[model samples]
Target: MLVTLREILEQAEQGNFAVGSFNSPTLESVRAVTEAAEELQSPIILSHAEVHNDIIPIEIIGPIFIQFAKQASVPVVVHLDHGSNLNIIKKAIDIGFTSVMIDASHMEYEDNIRIVQEVVDYAHKHNVSVEAELGMMTSSGIGGEETQGGEHHATQEAEDYYTDPLIAKDFVQKTEIDALAASFGTVHGIYVQEPNLDIKRLKAIYENIGRPVVMHGGSGLEIEDYVNVIQSGVRKINYYSYAAKAGAQAVKEYIQQNQNLFYHDYTVVAKQAIKEDVKRAMKIFMNNGY
Candidate 1:
């Protein structure tokens, strides 16, 4: 059934497990994630990043996502990821997105709160949930263009971008956001160095803010780290990069194995590979000895 982000995240918090917020920009991805969630009986979030407007225009994909959510057997949240402007966010909301993210972390602190507050007010009136980013992260994954690159920045310098626990509390209070995406040690795409999450800082943010904490750049982490982050208070995890990579690799392998395959055959291979990858992710998020 279609649900809001708040409802899903609240369930995640109670169960002490993170929900896989998969970036479902393509039809194959939407199918893979929704099917995987239903099979696992897991509440999943299907997200479309605003930056992917070129890949598939939101106008075309928005309603398709809503329809998929409504048809899914398990709870589903159709969310707008990394909505950099209010105009795009508003458009997603108008298109029936259950949740919208206002990513103003790159702006000044006061400006970030102001913009997020405006979005929260508007989104809440429509019975939608609002998520806001509090700290900056490297742009290395899909929808990562025009942002700071992780390869160009050193791992040690990442601490400079980590979210302040106290400030996160204040920002959530001022913006009245339903969820907070805070950066402690993860980047958007792949990790240049080993993935290390600041569990202490994450716990502090969760305790101070008293709301569901979201972790962007959720791909590329070890299974142990995924469990640790959930235990430390991460309720929503935005994962992509690797799952998409798996699908791309599957297509290449299929073409290599078969001399003459139709376009539909390739889509079948890609969709199945992505579905399996999503299922693995959902099991890990279950945090139930999977």
Candidate 2:
């Protein structure tokens, strides 16, 4: 049934495995995530990014997420990802989001501390979990056009922009966030080239924080990298672009192969493709299914 993000990650932490947070902008995507979780009996996080609200507003999507989480056989959590707007996050909490992220990484360290603390204080009072980003995951910087949603963070920042273990340790101590999404070597979306994860950096962050760590932009990472991340103490990974792209590509191929493409055919194909991808991802995150 529906579970808190804290609850989901605690088990992952204990098992030394990671849970995949798959973004879903539509009902089909949510269905695919739930189906995969059931098939593997794995706990899953179903996410809706703030940027995608333009297509499917969070208010409209929130109830559906709650319903799906409630009906799922395995534990499921509805999470708001990359939420910068305090009001929007509050609304998400009010409307039944089990977890919410406050992305203040774009701000100065002090400012981030202030904003995230404000959110953590409020969320904790309501019995909801809070996730905050400490490092700039992408190189685009915060104000850029791409920082709006699940945009894969830029790798260009890796050299000089990675999260300082000391700063992150302090941030977590002060803010008391349920989880922290810090940067190592991971980026968002498809990789132009394979990413070499900074295992040392991740290990450092994990040691200092000693809490559930989150990795965003996990769509195209190698299976080995995923294994390394989970082994390094990453409890949750955000995976989206790959699953969504898989569904869209399947629908396109189905239409091309059939002379008469029907509406229902596309829906069925999309669901099947998405479900398979989610299943594949779950297997990786859980180390080949539990």
Candidate 3:
């Protein structure tokens, strides 16, 4: 069933398990995510960022997302992630997205709050949930390319761009976002090396914020990190790079193994590959619940 982001996160908070928010840029990706959720009996969020909208076009992908959400056995929330502009966020709301993320983290604090508040006011009026980011998550992957206009990928050091607990308290109190995405030592995209998760910082922010928190750049984290972070108060975890890579790798392996691949159908190969990838990720996210 299609549900609000608040509703999904609330359930996660109550159940003591984080819900997986996977990015879907195509029909195969959507099917992979939703089918995994259905098989696991786990609630999931299907998210697409502004960059993805630009690539796939919202007019084509929006209705498909809605239809997939409606048909899923488990509850699903269709969300827009990392939406930096007001107009794009509004379009997502109009296109039937259950949740919209207003990512103004790169802006000054006050400016970020102003934009987020604007989105919150509008989303609330339409009964849609809003997610706001508190800190900038530097990335070393395709996201970096998207944000930096194809600039060189730079690894983010431990900087203070992340949300301070005291300031987080104020930001949440002021903007009133449904969920907060805090950057407690996690960077966007795949890390060049293993990134240490600042569990203590995460717990402190969660304590101060007094709301369900989200963890982005979840693709490269260790299993122990995931467990600890979820225990700390990460109600929603976002994954994209790993899932996409898995799908592509599966397709490549299939082609390499089959000599008569020329006669093979593309749709079936892609769907099966994506399905396996999603199932594998579901095991990790759901912890073998299915």
Single out the weakest 10-residue window by summed lDDT for candidate 2: 139-148
| Residue-level lDDT tens digits of model 1 in 117-140 | 899999999999999988787654
- Identify the candidate with maximal TM-score: 1
By how many angstroms RMSD does model 1 differ from the true structure? 2.2
Clashes of 2: 5
**Candidate 2 off by > 4 Å:** 139-146, 149-157
TM-score of each: 0.95, 0.94, 0.92
Q: For candidate 1, what is the TM-score?
A: 0.95
Any idea what lDDT model 2 has? 0.85
Q: lDDT per model, in order?
A: 0.86, 0.85, 0.80
lDDT of 3 by residue, 200-251 (tens): 8899999999899998888767777877888899888888877776666767
Q: Which ten contiguous residues of candidate 1 have the minimum total lDDT? A: 143-152
* Candidate 3 TM-score to native: 0.92
Indicate which candidate wins on lDDT. 1
